[model samples]
Target: MKITIWPAGILAIIFFISTSCKQNAPHEDAAEPAFVAHPVAVPKQDVMTLEIGKAAPDFRLPDVNGKFVSLSDFDEAKVLVIIFHCNHCPTAQAYEDRMIDFTNEYKEKGVDLVAIMPNSAMGLLPEECGYTDLNDSFEEMKIRYEYKKYNFPYLYDGDNQSIAIAYGPVATPHAFVFDKERKLQYSGRIDGVEKPGGANAEDLRAAVDALLAGKPVETPVNKVFGCTTKWAWKSEYGKKVEEKWNAQPSTISRLDEDGIMALVKNPTEKLRLINIWATWCAPCVMEYPELVALQRWYGHRNFEFVSLSADNPEHQDRALAFLEKTHSPVQNFIYAGTDKYKLIEAVDPKWDGALPYTLLVEPGGKVVYSSQGPVDLLELKRAIVEHPLMGRYY
Candidate 1:
């Protein structure tokens, strides 16, 4: 035969190559593995503010009484107004009376107004609350609603913020007006003036008036000027604030009797909150952090929180370490003298040489609050926030 006996190894290699080629070849009717699709990641789209003529976004939110209220509840009104307001914004506080008056005036005319607190408390840092006595929490919303005796509905959208994301308010005091059909006709500042006592609700009034008259609004949009809307995503900034505050140098100075007296005198125009604490005192160590928190809550306003350590001058390093551990960035001092009575007298005459004494001193040494034991933080907060110089509103 022309084909001699082939070597077994060569024949085996040729057979393997032919079988591998057949196995690798595609099948014509194998169903192509059922066209499996792996899920792909898509970026989230940003929610934009409502545009003029758009249908009002539906929402069911809780009012002060824990009763659920919805947009459809006001269907009988010929005109509707929604104010994205909060407890903490000075601009929103400035317009509270005006909003109340507007609600009263328009309710008889078949127009209804509702104030929606569209802020997430998680996004509100204590430092961002300098302008008011309360933060934008549902509980605080209830407090404000009751305090103001608001005629209109005051709903809270802070839990999930889905309603806020839908409305997309850029700032507190932002206003939206809707016609009888529940179509948005205007969105923006409540009026031209930022401060109170001008042409009250001029812009909002015009939009409501136009809609009630069955006419198109002349200015459908205006630039909003107020506290930036506290979106839930903004909570990330709280970490940065904490980091920045912790990075500050935690130094303690030696304050003699005179220096301590000077601190009590409060030369500056700020409301001074002074705490006298000893590193060895259990109550002092426990309550120190809350005092620091108070500093953050009202620091941006005309306020200062001074920490005067009852620790001896020689133990300043120990006191400084404690302050650093607590991330206290306020002015800190350690008593330079060994006399505890002088320290008590210098900080506050009313102090009975207690381990943890606190004082809220106004400028020129007027004592607004004094506590001997672990303070009731809420009471202390109220004292600080309700003071004349630190009032909630402008």
Candidate 2:
């Protein structure tokens, strides 16, 4: 179902519009949606290997201009090269000049070089990676192409990410080369240039060269590594980073009761995790990594998890110090001029609220699960498997 705003929020939105119109709103364009830092991890391939002889997966995607292009379109070509890339990923950007050189070199060889941006419709924020900005609409991608003078089609997979999952790409810059017979001959790193300049293992070039020689490609594949394909693998360290960040003094470490209440009121179909924790509690601190794991395991987008710090004002600094150290994902908040009971009751008077407590609130503000301790990943994963929602979060 489409999002239906509550009557009170609708009135507020109307009031906001009216207030904006009255002031002339000179800086209206300056407002931006808050950008959350995604949980980080070592990039690795989720798929370890691909068989040498199999038909390449076909895909249809839109170029920068929103024109549809398909894999089968190059049926007459002897070699079809597909590059899984994105505008914002550093690894893809690092190889920009090299990609242009490779595409140019093989075009005359009846090689169909198609570079595709396989962004998942879930989890990621495009603007965070510099792919899109506040002002970047589909039109902006086209303008960027002309401005950058790109020689290849910069395609977008807008439709529910059907092509990405089908291709099973493990990371950005994933290259696959197919012979004219449409059999998968090579798959792996662009040039074994894992970092900026390692050795020019040149895996893709070697495979292409072997195929062109009318000989079997010596190496069928290698372990591809780099910034992971955000759409391909689920993240597993949401709370670990948050705990690390929370330990830092520079970060704001309070759990704002008012802010959490607002989010509860504006809930989405995504699964919501509500954690009540404190600074002095060792169990809470110890379980911090698991919570982050739950978030990352849920892969950030699948679950909406927020943290409420129960530390007193005097301990706020220490709490923040811990947050900075661990890099927590639980949306930080604090309760002021109120006891825990009062605050919890005010948020929801239906039952008693306890420390180290977690509630899985589904959309429409329905409580799915409530417990007094840290959540178990296997149990939560089972729940997600059982219940189907439009958007899910851990």
Candidate 3:
């Protein structure tokens, strides 16, 4: 008897409700960025700290311009700092303001700041970490580098990672401070602070201030923590990449008369143990078994060993064959030239040029022992018995 709501009215009401619900719903948040994960497990290593009073190691590396720069170059400064840093580390990023302020405060005080980036793994090639890359394309690094207006150079560790390994630096922003006489004075965390927004102790700043005031730096070392250096060149290509970047003008890949003479002339005082032989020479061949053993015995010592092969163009093929045959543990290089005798004489002029000549050149280029024939291990061992650089195990 009462008029019921019509189906059309009900439909209209449902449609209105659906439309209202669609309009009021919240949107989903955008996806977050992803980072590349390490391929293998990295063992958590205890943070390493250098000791005070240890002689700060010296090293040379390329700046942004691909020029050689060394720690010794900053000798005139009253205090010197070598800081290992990277662009991506948040801990390192936190120090931007402090680094800038420190630079400004100490620049006029004759202190030098040298920041090293050991992130060679970030680049496709070993040489790409040059100054231009750090200055131009690395937005984060460039921004930090510019903001700091660092008085000192931000150096790149090219193919030869000699500096990073030498310092045993485990983190970004790892620091070592040296006094005027080049003795290590302080090393450790920038200031007892680890993460951002920590309480302000400023240990590093305090140490530097003390040194600048002509007072002894009481804090000699610190345990630095941050991202580890990711150096990529691992396999054969990696080796080539590193060698290409660190290639010196004086470096000779093939040992020739000219190269041997140059090394002999350059380091007059160091012990020079030159091993001359060839794959085809039989006695030069027969003695190789013993020579291979002797080479292994003394491989790790301080004396320089030049394993010269007179095989010329045939060197690579024959050397590989010899390596395959004996599974020889000795590392050897082939002498490439048409005239082997002239090359030998150029290295040492005293007598007839001969293969298997083993000579120990003193610091002054004096020949300690010159053996014209194949080397006897016992005889050679006796010659190097008490010698300073030849006593260590490989």
Residue 230 displacement (Å), model 2: 1.7
Q: What overall lDDT, based on C-alpha atoms, would model 3 receive against the true structure?
A: 0.61
* Per-prediction TM-score: 0.81, 0.46, 0.41
User: Which pairs, if any, clash in model 3?
Assistant: 64-131, 187-220, 187-221, 187-222, 188-222, 268-363, 269-363, 282-285, 300-394
Worst 10 residues of 2 by lDDT: 127-136
Q: Which candidate is the best by TM-score?
A: 1
lDDT by residue (tens digit), candidate 1, 28-55: 7775232221222222337689998899
Error of 2 at 146 (Å): 3.5
120 in model 2: Cα distance from truth in Å?
2.0
Task: Kindly provide the TM-score of model 2 when superposed on the true structure, using C-alpha atoms.
Answer: 0.46
Q: Judge candidate 2 at residue 179 and give its lDDT.
A: 95
lDDT of 3 by residue, 1-394 (tens): 8997679989999999999998887656644333222222223334334567777778776664446688789988988877887654546666656666777777888888788876544333322221111211223344546544655677766344556666667777788888888777887678766654573427777777889898986766667766556544333455675565335221114666767776566464446666677776766777766554433334434445556666775557766577446545344666667786687676687757656566766665667777887776545655663465543111
Considering every candidate listed, which one attains the maximal lDDT? 1
C-alpha local distance difference test of each model: 0.85, 0.63, 0.61
Off by over 4 Å in 1: 1-45, 280-283, 312-318, 376-379, 382-394
